[model samples]
Target: MAGKILISGGSGLIGTRLSEMLIDQGYEVAHLSRDPDKFSHYKTFRWDIQNSSIDENAITYADYIIHLAGAGLAEEKWTKERKREILRSRVDSTQLLLDGLRQHEHHVKGFVSASAIGIYGNSGDQLMSEESSYGEDFMAEVCKAWEAAVWQIKDLGIRTVILRTGIALSDKGGALPQMARPVKLMAGAPLGSGKQYMSWIHIDDLCRLYIRAIEDTTFAGVYNAVAPHPVTNQEFTEALAEAMHKPLVLPKVPSFALNLMLGEMSDVVLSGQRVSANKVLQTGFTFEYNYLDEALESFYKKHQN
Candidate 1:
């Protein structure tokens, strides 16, 4: 079932690794990028979401499409305008894909789009699954709209899968880098109450899930892409500190100070939901890095040399 796999946001954290893994599996990979020259690993195709223009050939060449395009939600302060950008980037990018596909003659088989467990909002220690109730917040709303647009791909008779992904732990350029940075300086501390559940997946496991979505025809609808065992913030910090051979000597960062610094974005870190990966497991997907300690060990060892 491995054929041409075209990806949006192919230059992003997940997409970069996913592209490499897919290529290794003998799949012809191409990227839908704003600048064709940006990626050297694959044939990059040009796309303009605002103008509703795309390299129609890219759409025609696809057996599967993994839509990972979206602006970083936690990268900046959520001003009124930034909020609109966060929601618009995902929704509009999807619309552009649909519009381009409608105009092109394509034999695309499946469409797998990235989503977030944030769809469940900050539900404290609640164990959230794919069927969990949606929480009322900006993240949930954004995920709701983002997923709604992805669902429309099914209207084209393309099998679609929406993965409600959690925090992906990688040393590349995601939360891990920012988290490990403080620990490296011996200024590490648990965030907020340190009791918020952090549902996370190793980057390798996440990349494998995307591969499964493309190959598994029955993989329709939504699934949470998180590790089965979620750890509290305190546990996560301690594991990371131990991995780096550092000690956590500071008190938990107060929620008030975090709110003052990051505003609404602080809620992303301060509050958490324990997401379930049972749905993904039922499909016989095995995770290589299920525990934080093991995953971090692999990440650190890889870059030590």
Candidate 2:
């Protein structure tokens, strides 16, 4: 099943690793970027989402397209302008790709997109599956629009899979390092209620799920990209501290304090969804790291080496 793979957001933490893995597996991988020079190693195609333009060659040269380009939800304060940017980045980039595929003559077999579990919102202890009801929060709204744009490509007869990703744990980037830093400093404490369920996946496991979605023809629709077992904020904090051989010496961070510090964005940390990975697992995809402790250990072991 080796063929040319076109990836948007190829410069991101997940995309960079995915490109390396795909190349090692004998797939030709190219990136869609605004500045092609930034990705000298891969065949880069220029695409300006704001201007609604993409290199047609980027479209026609692919057997599969992985859409991962989106504004970081937690990067900036969700102001009126930033909110529009968040929605536009995901929706517009998707429209650009959809338009490219439609206008160009190409044989794109499948389209795999990155979506967040935030679509399920802060569902408390309820286990959120792919079929769960969507939340009404801003993050959820962004994901709704994003996934809707992706479905347009499916309507065009391309096999599409959307992975509603949970918090991806990695030492390279994403949420792991940010969480571990305070632990190493002996100031580690659970945030919010310390009882909110945190559904997470090791980065490698997440990338592997993306690969499976591309290679497995039976894979379609949405799947939750998360570990089999989800832990509470307190459990995750403890596992993280133990992984780095650190001590937790501080009290839990209060939700009110987070609200004061982050405004609306505080929900990102103060609340969470207990997402299920059974949907992906039922597709015969096995996660390398199913538990929080082992996942944390694997990352810190790499760091220690």
Measured by TM-score, the strongest candidate is 2
Q: What is the lDDT of residue 120 in candidate 1?
A: 94
TM-score of each: 0.97, 0.98
Q: Candidates' lDDT values, in order?
A: 0.91, 0.92
CA RMSD of each candidate after superposition? 1.3, 1.1
- After aligning candidate 2 to the native by TM-score, how far in Å is the CA of 107 from where it should be? 0.7
Clashes of 1: 0
lDDT of 1 by residue, 1-305 (tens): 57999999888999999999998999999999888976377898899876777888888888889999999876899999999989998999999998877888899999999999999998998899888899899999999999999988899999999999999998888899899999999999999999999999999999999999999898999999999899999999999998888888899989999999999999899879899989899999999988889988988876555
Regions of candidate 2 where Cα sits further than 4 Å from its true position: none
How displaced is residue 48 in candidate 2, in Å?
0.2
After best superposition, candidate 2 residue 21: deviation in angstroms?
0.8
